[model samples]
Target: MNSSFSIGIPSGRNSSACGYCSPPGERSQGESSYQVAGFDAVQLTCQTYQGMIDRGWRRSGTWCYKPDLRASCCPQYTIRLDALQFKPSKSQRKVLNRWNRYVLEGEPDDAAASSQKSRSGKSSTEFVLPIAVHASEISNLSDESPTHRFEVTLEPSTFTEEKFTLYKKYQSTIHNDHKNSSAGFKRFLVESPLKDEPIPYPQTPPPYLPRQYGSYHQLYRIDGKLMAMAVLDILPTCVSSVYFMYDIDWEDHSLGKLSAMREVSLAREIHEAGVDNMLYLYMGFYIHSCPKMKYKGDYSPSFLADPETYEWFPLESCRPSLDTFRYACFSHPSHSSDEVITDEPDYLQVPLSSDDEKEIRMLVASGKRNFVVSLSESPYWQYDEIQRECLPCIHGLGIDLSKGVIFKI
Candidate 1:
């Protein structure tokens, strides 16, 4: 185990803020250094954070030094796994194979995602790369045991300009079903603003500013062509997800999950070496109403940040609250316990036609009383799931699920 790593907080409107990707780079400056057994910090500055350590921040169950900075509200957290304890899921294996196959054979399998469903169940060649440990120290885990053997090197990377061009081309190259999928969201990210007035985003992909922001970017390539890229920012506490993009042709390969898996492994390795408090993969916001966003909940041992408390609440405990359109943040062990949840504006109502109102009156007189209940009042409704299963279905109803239901005269 090696207790060698840098610490810092990333700032600005980076991907880490919105759960897209992470920050990049490493720079070291004179600062207060924190020390623990087996490791010593060289550059620790409370006011400024710069370190030469350039490992892209990893996100998962736990991160060692989740930074305490306000600008980086959502710091990248780390997921530490007992690597030996990990068993790849079916989808995970498929993705690993896809990357390997690409490495073995040349390009031209751009339409593979369509047929990926049929390519499951078999184990592909195992990817055995040198253990590229970036942290400063690596020591044997057990005392009085045979020397544990491991190799540390920079993980080979294959990012190039040609791949970036290819990625843009493949962006629109998916099945019609999924064409309108994440693309719509990407359009929103590029087009939509917090208000009607749009703030101009980087017109051209900004030059990789690793130093200015203390972020890392890694591009996974097969045969010299970029297949996927992850931009990360190493924060003091957690490794926040910025954005992840993969070639639509490679979706079946599950590059997205694989990248996440790698991050988990990295985080665990570092935590074992001594970044004790590093835990958790902050998967941004989970809109239960959005079917696409539900996958985020699949992560085990996951908790949602209580809107009211800014604390992390286990998904199990918070499941009931996600039903309504509005919610407040709760509390987490990482957060204070006295936090309270506040109500936000919500739409929870059923539309009523004049005739429907009259019929309701008749029903009331006939002893078939009519009542309207807001989703928030139900206490059992989850906004994310409802939105996924029933949307526009409940759309035009001036419904304020958080407010009282209107009764017809």
Candidate 2:
């Protein structure tokens, strides 16, 4: 109630140029990305944000939004991987082992890595994922050393000249956005409002291991040269991946997919360390219609959040429905037809101390929370129309987060 927990202002439904299959400088009818009510948050606790995500919300820096699956050309369904159940594919293991070998032995062992395919191929046969994932990092190494020092640093999100340079180069090389400015980079990656809360590790983890639940920039450096970075949210229940970028020179290594694997390991380490609730790796949106985005389902035993019910369904079980339509409802596959849902007003006063609440109300009736727009207030809603819009965010985020968040205009 006192601004220490969570504070979010609703941002109404909006549209953007679709990321997949939408060619530049071209406008096709009914081809655009849409998001339901979003929250431009000032701050949020790890637990509250975790709940927000489970209900289908995802955040970029400080802006949290849920996709409108029914109308968007590529309906984005929230997906997650169960870290405890994840089994690395042969190719995936090769990537990790190859990277680890290069760091520990200072050479790419592509052939050797491919040959040793038994049970993680590490020093232990038990196949400990947490250990295998960090084997290449300096923290886990012994006196026996390699030529290159592979260092992975976990620190709170902030701006720096080196990180900015890497960002600029990645943008220009991969995205062809040579003019990406530092301010824009900061807004998209560096700026975050998640407060750091210590991970509930049964025993305090090593210094190199992250000890907090908050937004972080996980930097990957080889021999002191910054090569890659993964923007992450270390929350109470999952390691929510925000974004990942690597130097174009290292694209062959598949750092993007490798980063996802490492994130799962991070969650596993926390879970194996005794945090029972920490079992998932929250991969952002799963757009099944897009080829580039569909690989997220490869992380088997994964689940997709039903847009209407907020229930989790196995990705494989939902694939049939997804293949049949752009917006598929796995919970009720018989009703696969796309349909927009209307949600009621999602506004409530944050409970406050009786005296404080009275004083604040007297000074400003809308004090500290007045901007959240209710869907019912829209003139179009009165006329009973639901075209080209996704499900209202109130339904996606549900009433708990709706009332808990302070409405921002």
Best lDDT among the predictions, by candidate number:
2
Q: Tens digit of lDDT per residue, candidate 2, span 1-409?
A: 4544566555456655577744521222455555456667787878778988887788887887776666566778899999999998867776787777777666655565545644454534655667678877876678867677888888999999999999999999999988888899999999887878878778877566688889999999988999999999988888899999999988877898789899999888778778888899998999776778888988867999987788999998898888776668877777676443323323321222334222211111265553333434322322222311212444445556545454433
TM-score of 1: 0.40
lDDT of 1 by residue, 272-336 (tens): 44455434444444545344566666555566544322345566666654442222223432332
- lDDT at position 99, candidate 2: 78
Provide the global lDDT of candidate 2 against the true structure.
Answer: 0.73
How close is every model to the real structure, measured as TM-score?
0.40, 0.83
**lDDT score of residue 9 within candidate 2:** 53
Top candidate, metric TM-score: 2
